[model samples]
Target: MTGKFIVIEGLEGAGKTTAINTVARILNQHNIDDLQFTREPGGTPIAEALRHIIKNGLDNEPLTDKAELLMLYAARIQLIDNVIKPALKAGKWVIGDRHDLSTQAYQGGGRQLDKTFMVTLKEQVLGNFKPDLTLYLDIDPEIGLMRARTRGELDRIEQQSLPFFERVRQCYLEIAKQDRTIITIDAGKSIDDVTKQIEQILTKWLTKQV
Candidate 1:
């Protein structure tokens, strides 16, 4: 049997890494031991190199919007084909830190790109591929940015304007509304509270799956 794919998505400093750990623990409690964890634009060696380029801007030339989009897709397809798909086929659950929705929110909404073109690109690259469940941790952009700043200097994409992130947040919410498989969580809450909510949600879903 093919295993499930669970994706955790949010803006920078949305506590996605911690949330992933929480999800893994929940899955373990349910005896789903075989698992794989991945992050995009990374997982495979080539994808990691792409991730470095995407996050760290060039000194002289800025990365073009279209180029960034293509790079993200390139990394995504590489991880999916080389790692995620094979693991699922072997009945290992895959948990991802981010996925295609990041592109939809950042490139489509943040960058204000052409939506139709984005859809065409997605279909061409991914076809019907999608996560079985997506937990979208929603937080105010200001709060998220503040948290991110404390860690270190912002990355290329992270240095975008406040308005950009507002659009990204709006896009995320809109997409979550349209997709029944996606669950929205208020990440503004305390970490303990967020983890509790995640556990509750996953427990209910897992029960149904059984």
Candidate 2:
């Protein structure tokens, strides 16, 4: 079988790291072990540099939302051409921490960028390229931010207001609803429960793949 690209997505503190681990474990259990892991805006070297700017800001130079969105796409295409696409061609299952959905949610929703521009950019750069499956962990922004706060420092995007995150979540939900390839998970539950849900989802998905 050819490689499948699976993405884990959520707002900050939605427990994506754990969900990624769970997905890997379940895939391994199914003997689908040739896995290539990637994180959005940072997989390739060029992408990583852009990621640093996106997260930490470059010398406190104010980053325009439109520029930030463009940087993310630049980093994304770099990773796709340099890392993800090659890995997939070699029969390695690509697991992503985030993908274009992030731009759709964060930039389009949170930053309120132009939807037409977002769509145009996505089509021009990505075309139809997308994850085979997406696991979205949904959580309350208030709770999510609290969890993020305990993790030390908040990044540039993480420092947004509650309403901003709420809009992001809303956008995520709206997109998820329109896409059956995307699975929504209630991340507000315990970690154990969340892991179990992922295992079940992957097991079923793998079965259908056969």
Candidate 3:
């Protein structure tokens, strides 16, 4: 049987790294050990290069919002073609740091890009491709940014204003409400509590797949 693609998404400091680990551990507990991990705008040589530029702008060059959005999709397509699709075909479950939902939130909502354009671009690039499951760890932007500040310097995207991240979070919630596959959890809780939530959600979802 083909494997599933599960994505973890949220604002910076939303504990995505820990959540990914929890998902992996739970999958292992279920005897699903063939796991392939990946991150957005990455997972391939080409995508990594794009990731670098996206994370840290090329020198002092101004990265336009439209360009940034396009680059993200470009990196995503490369990763999907070279890594994710192949892993799924091989029956190895693909665990991702972020996915298309990120663009819908970050670029579409945060950047305030035209909805028509965003929809058109998404269709043109990804078609019907999407994660089988998405776990969005939600937290207030103020608290999340404070946590992010402790992690050293912020990246280009991470350096956006608080209002920008607020928009991103709003978009995340709006979409999560509309999509059954996307699960939203309050990440402000303790790690153990968050892990319990993830385990419960994943275990129930996994049972249905079987």
Q: What TM-score would every model get versus the actual structure?
A: 0.98, 0.99, 0.98
lDDT of 3 by residue, 6-95 (tens): 999999999999999999999999999999999998989989999999999998999999999999999999999999999999999999
Q: Which stretches of candidate 2 lie over 4 Å from their true place?
A: none
Q: What's the CA error at residue 63 for candidate 1, in Å? A: 0.7
For all predictions, the C-alpha RMSD in Å is 0.9, 0.6, 0.7
Runs of candidate 3 with Cα error greater than 4 angstroms are: none
Off by over 4 Å in 1: none
**Could you tell me the lDDT of residue 166 within candidate 3?**
94
Better of 1 and 3 by TM-score: 3
TM-score of 2: 0.99
Clashes of 3: 0
Q: Which candidate, 1 or 2, would have the higher TM-score against the true structure?
A: 2
Q: Predictions ranked by TM-score, top down?
A: 2, 3, 1
State candidate 1's TM-score.
0.98
lDDT of 1 by residue, 40-115 (tens): 9999999999999999966757889999999999999999999999999999999999999999999999998899
